[model samples]
Target: MNKDIRNLSDRIEAVFPKMVQLRREFHQAPELSFHEEKTPARVAEILQALGLKVRTKVGGRGVVAVLEGGKPGRTVALRADMDALPIQDEKVCDYRSKVPGVMHACGHDGHTAALLGVAEILAGMREDIAGRFVLLFQHAEELVPGGAQEMIADNALDGVDAIYGVHLWTPFPYGVVGLRAGTLMAAADSFRIEVIGKGGHGGLPHKTTDAIVIASHLIVNLQSIISRQVDPLQSGVISVGHINGGQAFNVIAERCTIEGTVRSFDQEVRQFIKQQMERVIEQTCQMYGAQFELKYGWGYPPVVNDSSETTRMAAMARRIVGDDNVWEIPPLMTGEDFSYYLQKVPGCFAMVGAGNEEKGFIYPHHHPHFDFDERVMKTAAELLIRSGLGYLSADSPEVTVGNLYR
Candidate 1:
């Protein structure tokens, strides 16, 4: 089966042009979170054209396509996120987004295109393959309460076996691939803090409680949660991204607001940080004689990959990109809703490098100017193909996620 899977490189090569074309098309017309309509329609159209059993409007806007092989074995699933970001495209290229202020800033267009390429290649090899293949084209990965959970609730994973997925990462150079046995990404959560104080003329410092000054102090003090509260060996980050306060230079503001995100790998650490943050908020407000409110919302859990599946997929990746390029990288602070899928079944989430310095494709993801060397899409597609088939060819142990940190 490995030999047979290797032979699909020519097939992957043959489909590369179409993959680029599809990516560019999706890039030109991008869609955001829940507003996705035509993208999933086109996805269903493409999958239906390939003669697979397709389900649409799944869990809201997700699309699922099932391809059954001639020989029976187990069912394996491959997932790709289909939504774009709210960022406006800044690059001056032919395929730059047509939709104003909506762009595929994070390379989800490339993800969907690569998975479609895999479907095309595998559909042609159906007679020679065993087991079934489930292709999940999910929506709303950028926003929390993501499509993964909704899709799962819609019975997208009502099957017999394992799953696999990939992300085209720009930090690593083209041809390099990365994954870890434990947590690959962090659990993302967000919060909003409001400080209420007495207002007075700025010239009279003693007359006002000064909410703006309190918010500024709160921002600096919150870092202590990660530094002093959380264990030094463990990882945690509290970044305040947004803040609002006074209206005029001469006036002392009565209210101020602060908003930001929290990222961590451990559930207890996540909760502990929140508790410590609340403690800091209460103490700081009391000292300033200010009334305060804290609103915290939990997002996706951390993405933990199965040890056995990740090991097998890493061994498989060495064949395509060589042993040196296969990476067991440190866990990322980024969040992924794919964690929801891994919770229900055993699977592996892999990352393939799309950055290339020579071609000037070095922009990080989610930036307005973000873009990657499109050539790596083929490598990503091949990895998905090989991983999905490899999982089904042999009896794999049930997924067991190891420690949060290596």
Candidate 2:
């Protein structure tokens, strides 16, 4: 690493304790998706303490802090989500979530803490920095119709030239950075199928059209839509995560509900899956002599990173954490609303490895036991702040917002 960056990395290390303390505090009292109250307030307070202009209740519970540097240049944005999942915290630790039935199982706490660390550190060195920095503490990333839409609608990225975000992933081992050029994450869509049929006594011979039976058939048929219809080379998933109906074992169910999610990288394949699902539901209901109601909700688009940005970010990552630590990986089936921001500006969403089996933080995201090495927050901060500087440097070719300081 160069002298400047090595100094910056040391500065991030200096704030590592604050990042850990703040992360623990956030984890101890997490707020759920779309219902955040204290998290945003706390974030705004911290940013305000840094003497930066902070905007709160942004798009309802989202907070944005703008840091204008002492020098003149373009604008860059960094984002971190502030919402937690609905799962109960089952981990036995001092930082275990105090919010009953709500926890930060997805490493969002770490993301927020890392960004806040960056903001505090950068705020101290504003003169050396050329461009303004917009730190977005987004809400409700765990739920659809995510906060990214609301923030962007509220002009969060009004004068932003580029944006970047990170996720502290446990799947990758510690010190590893996962970066991909295109389709870093999939586009996720959810579907709900409701089957309506006749109710009758179980002892009666063929007296009722069983909705549960119809739902079962529909689930099986939905599998074929992706398995048999989609090309072998293409990737897609259609799993029925939930099913409900039938109160009694002897009585036939009059209605049944099935809910599942679809994930795909290709838009054509995404549309094709939806179409095939509709066809399968219609035909399956007809075959079972039942009626059906289907609800398919489109979710965030796939996270497609700009090739140039990914390359540039990768080069910076190598300098920060050596060549062996930087890695180019395949696309994941998971989804992120960071895709929303990427849609507005050329950005890259990279993952900082937090998994450490020796540390017993090996659980995957969204799991009740999910946790990570908090030290990874330092890596996250170094990458986010340095990458932003690299992009906003006066000599950089991609001088996106040099004139738009507002």
Please report, as a residue range, the 10-residue window in candidate 2 with the lowest summed lDDT.
397-406
| Residue-by-residue lDDT tens digits, candidate 1, 298-397 | 9999999988778768866877888888988999999999999999998889889999889888899999989999988888888888878877777433
Tens digit per residue, CA lDDT, model 2, 79-185? 99999999999999989999899999999999999999999999878877788999999999999989999999999999999988889999998898889887899
lDDT of 1 at 397: 34
| Model 1 CA lDDT for position 256 | 99
Measured by TM-score, the strongest candidate is 2
TM-scores for every candidate against the unseen true structure = 0.95, 0.96
lDDT of 2: 0.90
Please count the clashing residue pairs in each candidate, in the order shown: 0, 1
In order, the Cα lDDT scores of the candidates are: 0.91, 0.90
* Decoy 1 TM-score against native: 0.95
